[model samples]
Target: MSVLVYTENWDGRFKKLSNELVSYGSKLAEMLNTSTTVLSIGKVDEAELKSLGKYGADKIITVTDEKLATLDNRAYTAVIAQVVEKEKSGIVLLSNNNTGKAIAPRLSVKLKAGIASGITAVPEKTSPFTAAKKVFSGKAFAKFVIKTDIKILTLAQNSYEIVEKTGQAAIESFSPSVSNDLIRTKVINVEKQTGKVLLTDAEIVVSGGRGMKSPDNWGKIEELADLLGGATACSRPVSDEGWRPHEEHTGQTGKIIAPNLYIAFGISGAIQHLAGVSSSKFIVAVNTDKDAPIFEAADYGIVGDALQVLPKFVDAVKELKSL
Candidate 1:
């Protein structure tokens, strides 16, 4: 049996998590004493696909269908399921991102494989294939054992480290049995925020909340994020109040992120908000209320008015950069 990784691409390039998946799958393949293969969709540079060899992929199968360039969940799942069948992959690894969430369940059903989502660690035991994952909105951890012959796992972002190994991946073209009828939706046009880091892929995130008082005060938040070379985020209320876009919102009802560093300004750390960012490696909270719930969760906390403190913090960062 072989270990297969689904490496996702955006705008013809691989994201950081894609490399992590490859490396993770490679390590698992080594443990299983099998080869590791990667399946990529859409238009990606052949050279880049081959470079994944350094991450432990023995082979790279690419489907460069013009129609498959945009994400169509059904079509993508069908393609992946076909690859799993053809490769006889015992373990399938995917990133627990938007695409993985949308297509993983369908692929599991099609392949008749047991599936686990939001897995945070490598399999502890290979015989029963036990994996650790978060449950109850990150409040608890659970270990799952898959009994199926073939297993599918969607890994949480930043949960696994990327390790490089020496190897050259043999690239090949794979033509799956894709039908036009399987494509249920069409993406006519796409609008994306330009020149900013995507929250899911960012290492550092600076978030603001209702305590910012008004959208007019968001300049400092943006400036701080820019100065720190990070992305800007907000709590649910900030987006509801039109102070920030919904894409930037993070909470139980919003996007879940696990960045390396998450900084909060004027946020009270409601449980719902914590559910989204609780997995961050480090948290720094700045709020005027000393007893704010965020402080309990933060590694470092500043009890002061965010408006006055933000400028000073920005100046300090600038001074440090100059030195």
Candidate 2:
């Protein structure tokens, strides 16, 4: 038996979360005394497929079909299910993203496997199996045990540290018996977001809130993000005020992100927003209000005005890079 990792692609390249999942799944495979294989259903670049090796994928099983390019849940699920059946993978791992969230439940139903979503930690080998996960929207943690023949786990985004190994990963191409009728969805238009780092996949994130004073000062936010080699994020009010796009908003009602370093400028850290990024490895808050809730969640807190604090923080980052 082997561990199967579902590799996700965006614009012919594997997403960063996919690499993290591969690393996690590979470690799980080692723990279970098995190998790890990645399943990709699309026209991914061969070079990209091979790059999975560095992140801990033993083999990349790619079904390079035109129909599988755009994610048709039925078509993609059928292909993955076929691979799992043929390979007899004991454990299947998926990244807890929009795509993974959509497909994991369906796959679990079909496989009749015990499914765990929002899993943050590796399963502790007790008697059956216990997976650690966040519950009640990061308010609490729970250990869920699955007592099934086959198990499926969806890892939390940016929760696990990505492990890298030396040597090249092997690539294996397979042809699946794909049916045209299985393809229920068609891509009408693909509107790609133009940026280097997707917020969900970003390692560092610089976020702003209503305390920025006005939307005109967003250039500072963008500058800081650029200086730090990360992406810009905003709070719900900032997005509601049209200061930034809705895609950049991070809150319980918006996009949830758990970046490694989440630097917030002028944010109060409302529970709604904290629910989205409470899992960040390190948080640095730059708010003028000493009583701001953001400071409570921050590993490091600077009780200063955002307008003054942001420029200084940017200058400090630049100075450090020069040295």
Candidate 3:
């Protein structure tokens, strides 16, 4: 049995998370002494399928139909389940995105495989097949072992490194049994966000809180993010206050991110917010409160007013870049 990665894409282009999944899938396949196969649904082009080789997919399986252009939880789940069964895949890899979140649980029951979501690390050994996963929203780590022959794993976004392999793989076309009536989810419109990197996949994130005072004051945060080529995020109160969209909010109740660097300005670092971003590699907190809870999790802490500190920090960054 081989490892299978459910490669997710939008508008026929591969999403960044697909490479991260394939990276881990390829390593896992090597450990198991098997090849990694990538399974794509919908009408993705052949050239794009061959590019999977750069991300460690030994073979690409394209399952296409007109009905699959848009995501339908029921239809997609049925098709993926059929593929896993047909291939007798031992480990099924998935991205922990909207699509993977919708289909993983359903596919688990269909395949009778154990599932571990938000996984952070690869398997340590082979006999028991254990994988390390983050628990309590990044506060803790736990190990899970699959007793069944089939195993399903939904990896956290940006959790694994994308390993590149040279050479292309031959794309194989497949006609999976599908029901058009069941795949009734239709896409009416698509709205793309402008000028902001996605927070979930961003390596560096600069965030502000209610202390930013007003929406007009967001320029400093934006400038810092732009200079670093990263994303801008905000705390819950800022989103609730309508200074930013709810999508940019990060906290226990909001989206979770594990960027390489997380910079917090004026954020008090409530336990809930910390729970979401505690996985960041380095945390730098800038707040007036010397005893703010955020300082506890921050690798570096600066106690000062954000309004005074922000502009200076941005200027210093610009000056350093110029030098």
Candidate 4:
């Protein structure tokens, strides 16, 4: 049996998470002494599909259906299940992002496979197939083992490294036994936030909080993010105040992120907010309050007003770059 990874794409381009899945799955396949295959849906470029070979996919399966372009959880689950059975894949891997979170549970039920969601590492022990996962919003780690013959896993974003290998994956066309009737929901229109790094895929993130006082003051945060080529995020209160979009909110109740570097501006760290970003590799907190809870979680803490400090910090970065 081969290892099957669901490499998702949007607007004809593969996401960075998709490449990580391929890399993770391929390494796992090597450990299992099996081949790795990637299953993709929608209209992705043939060259892009074949390029997954460098990340360890031995074969790429593309299902080009107009109806499949819009994400219908039920329809996508059905297609994935069909592919798993056809490939006789014993292990299935998916990103634990929005789409995977939506479809994984449904697909697990359809395949009668034991699923482990939000796993942070590869299987620690292959014999028992134990995988490590983060729990309590990144506060704790737990090991989970799937007893079912067919195992499904949803990998946490940015947890695995992408290693390039030399190989050319063969691209094959796949038509799953999917019908239009299976699509219970239809997407009428799509509005996308364009020209910014998706938070989940960003290595560095610059975030602000209610301490920014108003949406008009977000310029500094955006400038920092732009300089670093990173994404901009906000705490939940900022989103609640409508100062920022909900998608940019990161906290226990919002999107969980684990970027390489997380810079917090004017954010007093609540446990909920920390829970969301505690997994970040390095955290820098800039707040006027020295006792801000965020400072306790930050690797480097600066007790100062963000509004006053941010401009100087940006100027320093610019000066360093020029030198």
RMSD of each: 1.2, 1.9, 1.7, 1.3
List the candidate 4 regions with Cα displacement exceeding 4 Å. Answer: none
Q: By descending TM-score, how would the candidates be arranged?
A: 1, 4, 3, 2
Residues 140-251 of candidate 4 have per-residue lDDT tens digits of 8889989999999999999888899998899999877778788888778878879988898999999999888899999888988999999999999999989999999999
Q: Report the lDDT tens digits of candidate 1 across residue range 1-323.
A: 89999978878788789889998999899899999999999888988898899899999999988778788999998899888889999999998998889988988898888998999878999988899888888888888889899999999988788899899999989998889888879788888868998888889899999888999998988898888889999999999988898999998889899999999999999999999999899999999999999999999989998888888989998999993
- Deviation in angstroms for 211 in model 1? 1.3
Candidate 3's C-alpha runs over 4 A off are none
TM-scores for every candidate against the unseen true structure? 0.97, 0.93, 0.95, 0.96
Q: How far is candidate 1 from the true structure (C-alpha RMSD, Å)?
A: 1.2
Best by lDDT: 4
TM-score of decoy 1: 0.97
lDDT of 3 at 137: 72
What number of clashing residue pairs does each candidate have, in the order they appear? 0, 0, 0, 0
User: Higher-lDDT candidate among 1 and 3?
Assistant: 1
Q: Please give the lDDT score for candidate 3.
A: 0.87
Q: Which lDDT values do the candidates have, in the order given? A: 0.90, 0.87, 0.87, 0.91
Instruction: State the lDDT of candidate 2 residue by residue for 8-50, as single tens digits.
Output: 7877887668878988998898788889999987778888888
* Candidate with best TM-score: 1
